[model samples]
Target chain A: MAITFPVEASHILMFARAVGDPNPVYNPASAPGGVIAPPTFGQAVAQFDPEYHLRPKPGQPWFGSGKTPSGVDKAPSAGGLHAEQHFEYLRPLRPGDVLTVEIKPGATWEKESKRAGKLTFRERIAEYRDQTGELVLIARGVGVTTERPVDQG
Target chain B: MALSASRIKPGDTHSETVVSNLTRTQIVQYAGASGDYNPIHTDEVYTTKAAGYPSVFAHGMLTMGLTGKMLTNYVGDGRLLKFGVRFTNQVWPGDTLVATATVTEVADLVVKLDVVTTNQDGKDVVRGSAEARIDP
Candidate 1:
């Protein structure tokens, strides 16, 4: 699926406050311009609306059956864990700067396990770029979809 | 609190830090603030019976927040560049966890550290690595 989302400054401030990140860049009082979003604020970019945010739709491949309106949940396994996360910051996020988050399946590895019995593990990689088309940050996240019992030996 | 990188030694050990007890309120707050609403963290029965856990547990990221406190309190603010951790063991309520970090590698611009947190029973609850950038 191809879509674009315009990230607003308010969304960044709300997320930073919620996570207890006291960085001045993220605080309105500290930033005369606007709040500076936290490093993890890139994760919120995945929820942007296509029509309202993107330039155009270039029909892309649809992989999963279920999809969250935020476009983050595309797997049938309603369950997901932040198994691992890594971020590289290129520049700080400023207020009133809209962003585009291009998401795609990074890697899909299926394994045969006595416990998991044989399920697919998917890693969704999302990259965020500011309105100026400069890379802001990259977020790589892994989600596990298993049909086996939570307790299987 | 400011952490002095110069005072840290390869073998220097920190006094054990006890979390005292984990509370449901803490988990709920973490869920709301962190945007992680995984049911296992909030649903006790589901976690206990379905997830094969002893009880409802804390978010790995929430525990990471505690670990971040351990680092920023040691290495000073605005110095950490890249910090990462893997969830090896699960932490539960009433389990007091201790965090410790040791300098593994040092340089003019970067220093590497190995960090860990364990329960009173000596069971390792979390293990990870952190890095900080030092002034030249």
Candidate 2:
């Protein structure tokens, strides 16, 4: 899936606030060519992704209460979690620039976990480019979902 | 403020950050901003009653995002070539957070750092490393 975001001063400003960042550079009045965004501003663009799978779907329960987006129906627990994240920035991002991002599923792996029994890890990649098709940034998210942790004696 | 690529060294350590206390509002807003409504990071009801956590925890991305903010403070945005983190502890509301970077490598126009986040209690909540281009 692809994402198009018309970078706004509000998003840049509010995102900084959301993370409790008090940098004045994020304010348009302070920075050149409008303010630049935080490094992880790339992730905030996911809100516009129509196919984003983390939200509560019609059949999926909220807060992973019953069944999570992983299509697994299990009792609510703190099992599925974000394991790792990476971002490769090709250039600086600023308000008023339209960023087009293309996302694709990456690789998957599994491992044994003492807390969660068996764990399955999956990755998704996002490539961000400008309207001119110039590459800007690349982001990868790795998530871990617990299958069933066996009880230890 | 672009960092001087020539002055960087493997042992050099310089990182700037905007420290802030975790808040529920930020958690919910991040959920709206990031399209991650997992509830474990925002919903106190489901998180406490069902998940069995004492309260909803902060999103790992939020801490990582703050670390990104730290990078921007030094090199400006879009200069980072690589940044990553491993979660170590659950971030609770009211926790004080600071993201830091210590230089680990400086070679071939690239600077690598050992990044970490700690709470006001001085406990590490996240550990990982990042790499960025030293030249703008």
Q: Per-residue alpha-carbon lDDT of model 2 for B8-40, expressed as tens digits?
A: 777776555445667898888878776778777
**How large is the interface RMSD of candidate 1?**
7.5
Candidate that would win on lDDT: 2
- Interface DockQ of each model: 0.17, 0.56
The DockQ-derived docking category for candidate 2 is medium
Best by DockQ: 2
lDDT of 1 by residue, A64-85 (tens): 2123222223322324444555
Residue pairs clashing in model 1 are: A25-A36, B3-B74
True contacts kept of each: 0.07, 0.72
The global Cα lDDT (0 to 1) of model 2 is 0.75
lDDT of 2 at B5: 75
